[model samples]
Target: MFNLENLFGKSTRGRRLKSADRVSGALPFITAGETDQGISAFIGNDVKVFSANTTTIDMFGSAKYRNFKYGGDDHIAVVHTNKLPKYASVFVTSAIHKSSYNGQFNYGRNFYAKDADALDISLPVKDGKPDYEIMETIISAIHKLVIKDVVLYVEKKKKELNKLTENANAVKC
Candidate 1:
C-alpha cells in the first residue's frame, strides 16, 4: 500500500463557483456528485486542471475519473504521476472507494486533503510492489466484455425493430 501523496503531485482545492455562475460557459466546472465524469457545469477557465488522467475525490466520497481535461471543486483532487498509466489511474479511483474512512464521509464529513494524503491504497502486488500492468490488463479485458455485450444487445434490438416494420408492411398490403 502506498500513500496518496507520493502518487499525486499535490492536493489543491477547486475554484468555488455558485450555481448562478454555471451558465453556458467554456470550462467543465465540476462539483461533488454520483457522475463518473463529475461535470456539474461549464463555467470560466479560472485555475483549471487540463490534465486528462486525473482523479477527483469529492467530499461525499464520490471519486470521479477525469478522462478529459476539466476543472472542478477539489475536495481531494489528485493529479496522475508521469509513471502512472491510464488504467492505473482508474484503479486508483476504485481503490479510493475501498478506503476505511469512506464510511465517515457518508455522514456529512468531507474527504479532505490531509486525510486523503494519509490514506493508503491497496494495489495489485508484484515483487511486493504495485503492479500497474496487471491493473491495465484487467481493465482492458472488462472493456472488451462490455463492448461485446453492448453490440449484441444493439443487434438484437435492431432485429426486433426490423421484424416490427415487416409486420406493419404486411398489414398494409
Candidate 2:
C-alpha cells in the first residue's frame, strides 16, 4: 500500500454541473453516488472537453469508470489517469475502491480533491510500478464469477416460477 498521489497526478480541473444549466441534448451530467454511472442526464450547448474514460469518485468512496465525456456536480472529484494507456485506468479504478479512505466519505466526511489525493491505496505491483496485466486478469476473473452467479440466480428463479405455475394449472384443471 502506498499514497495514491504516487501513482496519479492531480485531479482533473473542471467546473461542477449546475441543475439550472441542464438542457436536452448530448453529453452526460454526473452526480455523487456509489454508482450513478456518471450519468444523471444528457444535455448539450455547455459542451466542454472533460473527455471519456475518466474516473469519478464520490464522497462515499464509490468509484465509477465513465465511458464518455461527462460533466459532474461539485461533490464528485475526477481523477486524471490519462497518462496511463487505454483501459489501464480500470486498474486504478479498482485501486480507488480498495483505498481505506473510501468508506470514510459520508454525511460527516466529504471526500474532495485533496482527500482523494491523500488517500492510501493498494495496487498490484511489479518492480515498484502498478502491475496492469495482473490487474486486468484479476478483474476479468471476478467479472466472470459475477456473471456466473447471476445466471445461477436467474435459473433458480425460473425453476421456482415454473413450479408455481404448474401448481396453479393443476388446481384449475
Candidate 3:
C-alpha cells in the first residue's frame, strides 16, 4: 500500500466555475456529479486544461477515469496519472474509487486535493515497486470479458426480436 500522491504524482484542485458563466463548446467541464463521468457541461471558456489519462475525484469522494483533456471545477481533485500507461491509470482510478468512495466525504466534509494526497491504496507490487505490466494485463482481460458479454447479450436480443416478428407475421397471414 502507498499514498496516492506517491503512487501517482502531484495532485491538484480545480478552479471554480459557475454555471451562469459557462458557454457551450467542445471542452468538457468536470464537476462533482457522478453522472456522465462528472461532466457538468461543455464550454469554450479558457479554463486550465488537464491532460489525458488522469483521474478526477469529486468532493463526494467519487473517482472517475478521464481519457480526454478536460476542465474541472473546485469541487474536483485532479490526480496526475498521465505518467502511467492508459490501462495502468485505469487500474489506479479503480483503486482510488474503492479506497475513497465510502460515504465518508460529503457536503459538510468534502474531498479535496489534500485528501487525495493522503489517501492510501493497495496496488500490485513487484520488487517493492508497482507492477504496471500486471495492472495493464488485468484491465485488458477485463475489457475482453465485458465485450464478450455485450456481444452475447446482443445476439440473444436479436434472436428474441426475430421470433416475435415471425410470430406476428404468421398471425397476420
Candidate 4:
C-alpha cells in the first residue's frame, strides 16, 4: 500500500502553490478574478506554467487536499517527488504571528528540502543517507503518544473542573 504521508515530508508537505519555477526563475503572478468565468480563465492559462493545472503528478487520494496556500489565492498544488529534479529542493514558508509581543514573523526552519538544501534535522541518517523508513516509524510513534497523552490529560482536567463547579454551587447554596 502507498503511504501518502510518507510521500510528502512534513517540511515539504504544506506549501502554497505559486506559479514560480526555480529552474525557469519565474514567480507566480497574482491576478484578481471578477467572476467564475475569469477564475476558470486564470486556471486554464496557468495550467501550462504549473503542472497542477494540466498534469496530475501527485493527484493521489487525499494528497490533493494536503497543501498550503500561496498568498490569498486558494489554488492548491499537490507537491510530488516525480515532478522535482534531483537537484531541486522543497521550500517551506512558515509565517508565525504572536500577539504577546509585537506581531513578528519567523520561519522556524529555513527552506528545508531533500537535496543539498535539506535541513540536518535529527532524522535517522545511515552512512550520510536519510533512513526514511526509520524516521517515518519514529514520527508516527511520537504522534500517537502525544495524542494519547493529550486525550488523557483533557479527561482528567474535565473531571477536576466538574468537581470544582459542584463545590462552588454548594457554597453558594
Please list the C-alpha lDDT of all candidates, in the order they appear: 0.71, 0.72, 0.94, 0.31
Clashing pairs in 4: none
Q: Tens-digit lDDT track for model 2 on 1-173?
A: 76766667776534676768778877777777644564777777464556676677876767777666777777777887666654567777777877734366787887777877887777778998878778777777777899999999999999999999999999999
- Global Cα lDDT for candidate 4: 0.31
**lDDT of candidate 3?**
0.94
Candidate 3 ranges beyond 4 A from true positions: none
Q: For model 2, how many clashes?
A: 0
Predicted structure 2: lDDT: 0.72
Determine the backbone clash count of candidate 4: 0
Q: Name the regions of candidate 1 deviating beyond 4 angstroms.
A: 21-24, 35-37, 74-76, 79-83
- What local lDDT does model 2 show for residue 58? 73
**Stronger candidate by TM-score (3 vs 4):** 3
* Top candidate (TM-score): 3
Using lDDT as the measure, what is the rank order of every candidate, best first?
3, 2, 1, 4
Better of 1 and 2 by lDDT: 2
Which tens-of-lDDT digit does each residue in 1-173 have in candidate 4? 12223534422222333555222323332222323211222222222332231111111111111122122133222234333222111111100001111212123322112221222223335676545455446556766899999999999999999999999999999
Candidate no. 1 TM-score: 0.85
